[model samples]
Target: MMQYRVEFVTLCALMVLAAGAWGFVALVQFAHAAEPHGFDQRILLLFRDPANLSQTIGPAWVHEAVRDFTSLGSVTVLITVILIAMLFMLFSRRPGGALFLLVAVVGGQLLNSWLKVLIDRPRPELVPHAAEVFTLSFPSGHAMLAAVTYLTVGALCARVVHGRMLKAYVMSVAVVLTVLIGISRLYLGVHWPSDVLAGWCAGSAWAVLCWLLARAVLSRRRAGEGLAESA
Candidate 1:
């Protein structure tokens, strides 16, 4: 049992570390190419459509949906979700798991926000915007938040799921939701593609890294417990 635990932890750590490293490298490379104007510019480049759907959808719909979606911004909502998960893990006596989820989701948010400040890229002005937002736009906060929330939930769900197929299904749904939110930014002409891409990579790295860290910590703790029991 000890050996198996160690092996599982080692495998998970290696996978996560590799992923984080790759994401960091990609982010650097992408930064060098051009300032990320976000998915809006890329959408225009690809579709050659100057139409701003937000305007056509009418101010009422635009304000309603955008405000609703952006209201996911409420720190209260974020805290509530994390607290629920943390409470669940605590109930299960899974401290390490709870810590991992907390760090990944919350830490990812901080990282994304800090990166935006550091990059300080402007939103696309190539076309008219339906709504005005003051936040720096390099990495879409919405995209990153969506990824971390969904992926963390998916990871936790994987533990309760009975089979590999079930795990795959859970993870797939999370990924799809993340992608759609990112794409929505483009569809709404709010973010650049590169912003969404960067957010995806960074958020993914955070999720995987937290998983690896949790596995490693849990394995070591269990191994120590076993040793103590044996002695």
Candidate 2:
């Protein structure tokens, strides 16, 4: 039964990875075309005031709130969270898990940077940006990093958690944070909707890939120990 469960999880992760990769590639093609997609512009404009494109569609507080949420995905905040989580894992005597998380998140960040440079998509100019941006906008770095870090952390937490409900809650919170961060980028007019979508696809795929690799390594280690004990 445990073997079957592991197989199921492996299968599901592979499926998600494939789907995400496909979606990202499709978006890349669209983004690379001579003309930008109309939907990208249309979706971005939806968040801006019709009369004055310089302003967002909500009260001052809403803009500030969105910025706050967006900051959750920022490099500074994410790295701080990661460091805290890693220290907790180390102190708990789960050094391997801490290392796994560090590699996964840092790898995801490097991958995001490479993709951004490769795609070279420009930031949206249809509306005034509500927040500062310093990177290329093919895949919103905030969206991608949010998905990578939060989902990876959630997965690690779920593994140690006791009950199904608790596990689901952790994962749901991760998903919610990832979604909200991506949407905040849209609302802030720093990224096109396509950019956010592609970020999610790429980030999710990377996270699953890392999980699968970690699982494979553990399985091999366990098998080796079992064989040695029998001998």
Candidate 3:
């Protein structure tokens, strides 16, 4: 029974990884087109007032709120969260888990950077940017990192926690954060919609790949322990 469950999980992870990779590749082709996607501009326009493109559609407080949510996915914030989580894991005597998380996050960051440079998509210029951005914008770094960090951490947390409901709650929060971060990029006019979508696709794929690798390693370790005990 346990073996069957593990196999099912492995299958699901592989499916997610494949779908995400395919989606990202499709988005890359769209990004490379001579003109911006029509929906990209339309979505960006939706967030801004028609008369005043400089200002977002929402009230002043809502704009500030969006910025706050966006910051959660910023490099500084994500790095800080990773460091803190690593420290927690170490103190809890889960050094292996801590190391796995660090490698996963750092690897994801490198992948995101490489993709951005490879695509070299420019930031949107249709409306004024609500936030500062200095990097190439094919895949929104905030969106990608948010998906990577939050989803990875959430998966780890779910493994340690008890009960299906609790695990579901943790993963739900992670998904919500990732989705909001992507939307915030669109609202802020710093990234095209396709950029956010690509970020999500690539980030999700990377996260699932890391999870599958970790699971395989754990299974091997357990099998080795079983063999030793039998011997």
Which is the winner by TM-score between candidate 2 and candidate 3? Answer: 2
Instruction: Show model 3 residue runs off by greater than 4 Å.
Output: none
Which candidate number has the best TM-score? Answer: 2
In model 1, which residue pairs have backbone atoms overlapping below 3 Å? Answer: 38-191, 38-192, 38-193, 39-191, 39-192, 39-193, 40-191, 40-192
How does model 1 fare in lDDT?
Answer: 0.70
lDDT of 3 by residue, 1-231 (tens): 997987898898999999999999999976898888898889889999999999898789999999999999998999998999889888989898798889899999999999989989989899999999999998889988899999998998898899999999999999999999999999999999999999999999999999988988988999999999999
* Candidate 2 backbone collisions, by pair: none
Error of 2 at 73 (Å): 0.5
**How would you encode candidate 2's per-residue C-alpha lDDT over 1-231 as one tens digit per residue?**
998987888899999999999999889976697777898989989998899999998899999999999999999999998999899889989888899999999999999999999988888888888888899998889988999999999998898898989999999999999999999999999998999999999999999999989988998999999999999
Per-model TM values vs. the true structure: 0.76, 0.98, 0.97
Q: Candidate 2 overall Cα lDDT vs. reference?
A: 0.92
Model 3 worst lDDT window (10 residues) = 28-37
Model 1 spans > 4 angstroms off: 1-20, 27-40, 45-77, 91-95
Angstrom error at residue 21, model 1: 4.0
Residue 213 miss distance in model 2 (angstroms): 0.2
